[model samples]
Target: MSESALQSVIHTGDGRTLTRSEFLSLINTYNWFLKDQAQLHLTYSQQDRDGEVTVEGFLNISWGVTMPIRLQIQDDKQTPPSPLITPEISIPVSPLESKRGMTRWGEYSDLHQIDENAETPDIIISNVPPAPIPYETTTLRPMRHKNTEQEAESNLVRCQSDASLVKMRRKAKTAAQREEERQHRFSINGHFYNYKTSIFTPTHGASTKVRITSRMSTHQVIEQLLHKFKIENDPEEFALYCVHQSGEKRKLCNRDQPLWERILQGPSEDIMKVFLMDREEEEVSNDVAQYLNLELPILEQVLLKLREEESKEIQRVISKYHHQHRLLSNVLNCKVSPHIETSV
Candidate 1:
C-alpha cells in the first residue's frame, strides 16, 4: 500500500484516523508520556490479510511488570477500522533476578563478622631509656621568683597609669572645644548675636530685635519676645512672616518648627527680615505695607471701570422699555378711531 494509505488507518484508544506521519507523530507523543512509567520499543508490519496492519512492541512497565503488546488495524469500507491493542500474558518475574546487586536484610551483619574474623599481626615494642640532665643547666631557684613577680606588678601599674592619663587629656580637650564653640557668635545685619546670651531690645510697637538660636521654635521665640517686651497679647494671636526683597510676605504656618528650618525656608540671602504680626489686628511689616500702598491706584482704576459697565447696562434696559410702550399706543389709536368714507 501507499504511504498515505497506511497513515489513513484509524488508531484505537483515542478513536482517530491518522496518516503515516500522524501515526508516527502519535507514537512519538506516547513515547514521552510513557517515558517515566515504562520502557517501550515499537515495530510496525503488514499482516497476511489484505488491508490489515499490525504494530508489535515490548513494554516493561513500572513495578517489574513486563508484557508484549500487539495492535491490529483492519480496514472496513463502511466505517473507519478500530485498532485492537492486546497485551501478551505477563510472565511472573523472579525476585532474585530483579535484585541482583541489591543487598539483603542480613548482609550488614555478615560483613561485620568477616571483618572481626580477619587476624592482625602481633607488634613488638622495646622500652625507652630516661634522658640524663646536664649539670650546667640546673637552677637553684623556682620558675617564678620574687624579682620577676615584682617586675610584672610594676608593668601592670604603668599600663593603668598611661590609660588614666590618656582619658584625662581627652576629657580636657573636649571641654575646651565645647567652651570655645559656646562662646562663638554669628552676625546678622552687622549685629553680632550670641546664642548663649539673650540679646534683645524691646520697643513699644510690640516689636523687638531678638537673638534666635537653632534650638528655639517659632512659638518659643515669640514667647521670649513677649516676655522681654512685656506685651500682654495672647500667644495664639501672634504669627511670624518672612519678608522678601520683592516685598511679598510668607506666613510661617508651623509655629512649632525650629528657627533653623524657618531660616532655611527663607531666601538664599545671609540676612532676612522676619516680622511678628498680630493676627487679630492684621499688622503687616513696613515693607509689606509699602507694597500694598503702591497697588492702591491700580485697585481704584479697576473699581471705576466696573461702575461704568453697570451704568451702561441700566440705560440699555430703560430704552428697551420706552420703545415697547410707544409701539403699543400706536396700535390702540388705530383700533379706536372711526374711518369716514368720501364721495366716489
Candidate 2:
C-alpha cells in the first residue's frame, strides 16, 4: 500500500483506506489466493462478486466504485470444526514455496521437533521490517530468503502488466464468425408462445423470452429451456407442441427447426404458441389458460427489439456492399492501368 494513493480518497467509519486495485492484489496473493491457493471467491456489498477469473485470464479493478477491505475468515483448520477462525490461523501454502531446503538457523529454530533439513515457508509476523524506527532492538529480524526474493520479482512482473482491460492474441474475424457471434450474443425482437400443462412456479407470470439462435434445432431449444428453468428432467421425455392461431397443434421432431419459418410468415395478430408438453400426454388440455393481456405487453417489447435487430442487419448489409464495391473498383483500376501502359 502506497501512502500517495490516500491523498484523494474517502475512508470507512473505522478509518481504513486502500485503492480497489491494491486491495485485489493483496487478497489474491500469498495466504488469500483464490485461484491458485484457497480456491474461493471474493465478494463485496449487495452480493456483488469479484475474482471470477482463471490463472491466465485477467480481472481488473472497478475504479468508479470501491468496497471495504477488512478480511473475514469464515472457516479455519480446527479440531472440532467450528465456523469461526481459530486463535492461530494456519498459513496458506504459497505458490513459490518448495518442500525441500533447510532453515538457516537450523537447531536454534523454534520448530526443533521437526527434522532440521526440511524448510518451512512461514515467517514470524513480528520479524516484519520496522517502519522508520529510531534504532534496532534485540528482537531478531528475518532476512530475505530465496523464496521471498522470487515472490517479490514475480509480483513486480504482474504489476507491470495492464490492470484495466484485458489484452489477448486474436485473429481477424471471418464472415462466418461474425454471423455466429451476432446470432448468439445480439438480442433481437423474438416472441415464443409457451402453452404449459405443468406449472413451473406458483406465482403466474410471463417469462416471455428464452435465449435462442435461428439455427438451433427443436432438441437444442428444449435443452436450453429446461436448463434455464433448472429442471433436472431428461430432455427426451418432453416434446414441443406448435399451436397455430387457428388452433392447429403439431408436435415437432427433434431435428426440425424450433422456430418454424412458415409459421413466422403469419400476420402479427395471428400469434402462435409452442407448448412444452410431456411426451406421455395424449394432447394439450383446452383448460391450459391463456392470458393475452400479460402476453401483449411482452409482444410489444419484442416488436421494439425486432426493429433494433432489423436496423442493425440493414447497417451490416450496407457496409458489406460498400466493402465489396471498393474491392471491385481496385481490381478494375489495376487491369486498366496495365492496358494503358502497353498502349503508351
Best by lDDT, which number? 1
Cα TM-score per model: 0.24, 0.25
Candidate 2 global TM-score: 0.25
Once fitted onto the true fold, the runs of candidate 1 whose alpha carbons sit more than 4 angstroms away are 1-207, 213-215, 229-233, 254-262, 265-272, 283-299, 305-344
lDDT of each: 0.47, 0.44
Candidate 1 residues 32-80, lDDT tens each? 5446644343345655666434454431101100111111121121332
Candidate 2 residues 1-344, lDDT tens each?
A: 46564343322212344454544454345224334533233333221253222111111101110111111111222223223434353355556655654324333222223433333455346767768844545568755335887777776534532211122223465444465444332111121112242222212112233545434567887777655443446777777665555545566677665533222322122455555666654543333223233477887887799899999999999999999999999999988884434553
**What is the alpha-carbon lDDT of model 1 when measured against the actual structure?**
0.47
Cα lDDT over the full model 2: 0.44
Colliding pairs, model 2: 189-305, 189-306
What residue pairs are clashing in model 1?
A: 7-18, 7-19, 7-20
For model 1 the TM-score comes to: 0.24
